[model samples]
Target chain A: MTDEQRRRRGRPRSEQAHDAVLAAARELLAEVGYARLTIEGVAARAGVGKTTIYRWWSSKAELVAEILYRPISIEEIPESGSPRDDLAANIRLIVEPFTDPWYGPALTGARNDLNADPEGQKAFQAQIMSGRRDTGRAVFQRLVDAGDLPPDTDVDYLIDVMSGLLVYRGAIWRQPITEEDVRKLVALLVDGRPPRRTPS
Target chain B: MTDEQRRRRGRPRSEQAHDAVLAAARELLAEVGYARLTIEGVAARAGVGKTTIYRWWSSKAELVAEILYRPISIEEIPESGSPRDDLAANIRLIVEPFTDPWYGPALTGARNDLNADPEGQKAFQAQIMSGRRDTGRAVFQRLVDAGDLPPDTDVDYLIDVMSGLLVYRGAIWRQPITEEDVRKLVALLVDGRPPRRTPS
Candidate 1:
C-alpha cells in the first residue's frame, strides 16, 4: 500500500471515526434537511470534534457529495432487449430513487448548494450529469436503432426535456411522477401514441 | 389619500429615499448577483440608512421580490385564433425575455434565493407562478377548444412539462431556449408533427 494508505489504515481509531462520521451525516441528513444540516450537528452526533470533520472535509457540500452519490449508477441501466421496457426502466431508475425518504431530502437540498459552487457544479457535471447523459444516449440510440425514434433526433435535447420534467416534478414541485405521466412522456417524446394504441 | 399616504408624500425626502433604494437594489442586483447582494450594500448605494431599507422591505428577498416581477405578465398572452401560431408565440413569451442581459442574471440568481425562502416562495407563487400558470392555461385551453389536442389531455401536466423544460433550460442549466428548441417543444407537447407537417 502507499504510505498515506498505510498510515490511514494503521490507526483503527481514524478508520472507525471516518465510518461514524459518514453514518452520522446520513442519519442527520434524513432527520434535518440539508438547509439545517450543520457540521457541528454531525460532529456532535458522530461524537467527534468539529475540527475532526473539518480536517477531512473543508465544506458541508463536500461532505454531502460523499454521502449523496448517484443512487442509480450507469452500469445499472437495465438493458432488457425490449427497448420499450428498457426505456421505462431507465426513466424509473433516474426518477424513482430521489423519491426515497432518505435520499430525496439530501439530493434536492445539496443540489442548490452544488448549483452555487462552481467547483461543485463541475464535479456534479462530471460525476452525475455525464453518467445521466450517457444513460440517456444509450436509451435514445437503441430507440433509433429499433426504428422507434427518428434517426436524426437530437438526443441531448431530448434527454434534457425528459430529465428536466422528472427532476422538476420530483424535486422542485414535490410531486410524484405517476405511471400515467411516464406513459404520456414516453409517448409524446418517442412516437406520439400510448402503447395500447400501437398495433402489436 | 389615506393619512399615512399623505404623510409619506408630505416628506419629499422619504419618497426620494424609497425610489433611490429600489434603483440601487436593481443596479446592485445586476452588478453582483443575488447571493452577494446585501441590505448594507443597498443602503450605501442609496445613501440611506440600513434601517431605511429594513423599514420598507423586511429582507433582501423581499426587495428582490419587488425587483424581480414577472417579465411576461399573463395578460400579454396572444389570442390570435390560430392555435399553432399562438402556441409558438406563448413559448417565446415565457422563454425569450430571460435571455436578456439584465433580467436573465437577476432572475436566475434570485431563483435560488427564492427557493430557499418560504415567505418569498409564497409571494413568488402568488405573483409569478399564478400568472404563468394562467397564461399556459389560456393557451392550452384554446388548443383544446380548437380540436388540436385530445379531449382528455391533462392540461396541467403538459404545462408542467413545457414550463419545466424551459425553466430548467433557461434558469437552471443556463442555456438559451433557442427557436429550434421552442419548435421541438411545441411539437412534442401539442401534437406529433412539426408546424411544417400541418398544411396551412
Candidate 2:
C-alpha cells in the first residue's frame, strides 16, 4: 500500500464526525429533551449523514449517556488525601456535572427518557456506574488503609447510601444538597457520633 | 324542573365514569406503562367517551396520580403504638404501594413520565407529597412527644436522609429496601451506635 493510502486509512473522517455528533447531541438534548429527540434530528444538527451517527451510536440513549457522562472519569476523584476531605471533594466533583446549566437540563431530559424503559435504565447505569464505582472503591480502600473507616465497612453499600441520599434529595424532593449536609453525613457515618445539640 | 332531572344534575354520569376511568387507567398503566398510555386508550378500555374523562380530569397525569395515590391518606398509618414500632410500620405501609405488583409498575411509569418535565414533577410532588409529608410529620411529632427523638434532632433533615436512603436504593440502585434494612437504619439513627464488628 502507498504511504498516503496507509496514513489516510489510519486517520479517517470518523474522528471528526464523532466529535461533531457528540457536540450536536449535547446542544440538542438541552433544547428538546429526550422524549422529543430523534437520531435523524441529531444527524442533521451535526451536519453528518444518518449513517454516520448510526455507525457510532446505535441509539439516542447511548449517545446522550456518553454526552452527559464523558467528563466523569475515575481520575477526576483523587484518593491520596485525608479520607473525609477526599470523599467530600470527590462527591463535589461527581455532582458538578449535574449542577452545570448546560449538562443539568440535558441530563434530566435524558434520565427521564432512560428511566421510562427498564432495560435502557439498566444498560445506562452499567455503562456509567461501573467506572464511577471503581473510583469510589479506591477512596474506600484508602480510608481502610489509613484506618479512618472500619476494617470491614461495606464499601459498595456505603457508596450506595451516600449517593442515594444526594440523588433522592435532588431528584425526588428537588432540593439542593448542601455541602454542609455532605460534611455532616460523612462525619456522622465515619465518626458514629451525632453532633452535640446546638441551641435552636 | 323535575325531581329526576335535579337528581341527574346533582349526580351525573361523571360519578360512574370516574370509577371506570380510574380502574381502566390503572390496568392499562400496568399493562403498557406510562410511556405507552393515552387518554383515548383509557377511555376506550373503560367503554366511556373521551368527554367523560376530560370532564372529570383535566389530563392523564392528574388521573394517573389520583388512581395510584388515592389510598395514601394521613390516617391510613395508625399511631397507637410505640414510636419506633409505629415508625417502622408506617414506613413499611408507605412503601407498600411501590412494592405491590399492580401499583408498583404503574407508579414507576408515572414517576418516569413526571420526572422528565420539571413543571409536572413539581405539581405531582406538591399534590402527592403534601399529604404524605403530613403523615411523616405526625410520626415525628409522636416520636418527639414520646422522647424517642432528641429535642434538637433536625427532624426534617433526618427524615430526608431516611427517605433518601430508601429512594436511592429503590429508584437509582433498583435494589429493594428490605424490612431489615429499614429497621437497622431506624435503629442506627436513633441509637447513634455503630455495630460491633466481627473478627475477620
User: Which candidate tops lDDT?
Assistant: 1
lDDT of each: 0.73, 0.69
Each candidate's iRMS in angstroms? 5.3, 3.3
Top candidate, metric DockQ: 2
lDDT tens readout by residue for model 1, A89-161 = 7887777656656564465456556656767667666775677778788887888899887667777877777
Q: Which ten residues in a row have the lowest lDDT in candidate 1 chain B?
A: B191-200
User: What is candidate 2's lDDT per residue for A6-78, written digit by digit as tens?
Assistant: 8867885889789899989878777876667799998999899999997866668778877766645657766
Model 2 score (lDDT): 0.69
Q: What is the lDDT of residue B196 in candidate 1?
A: 29
User: lDDT tens string, model 2, B77-155?
Assistant: 6766788877787677656556545454455556655655567666766777777777776777687788877676666
Residue lDDT tens for model 1, B1-200: 99999987788887889989988988987788777889999999999999988887767877876676544554676678788778788888777655655554455455556666767767766776777777787888888899888667677777887878886788666788877788878777777642222222
Computed on C-alphas against the true complex, the DockQ of each candidate is 0.21, 0.31
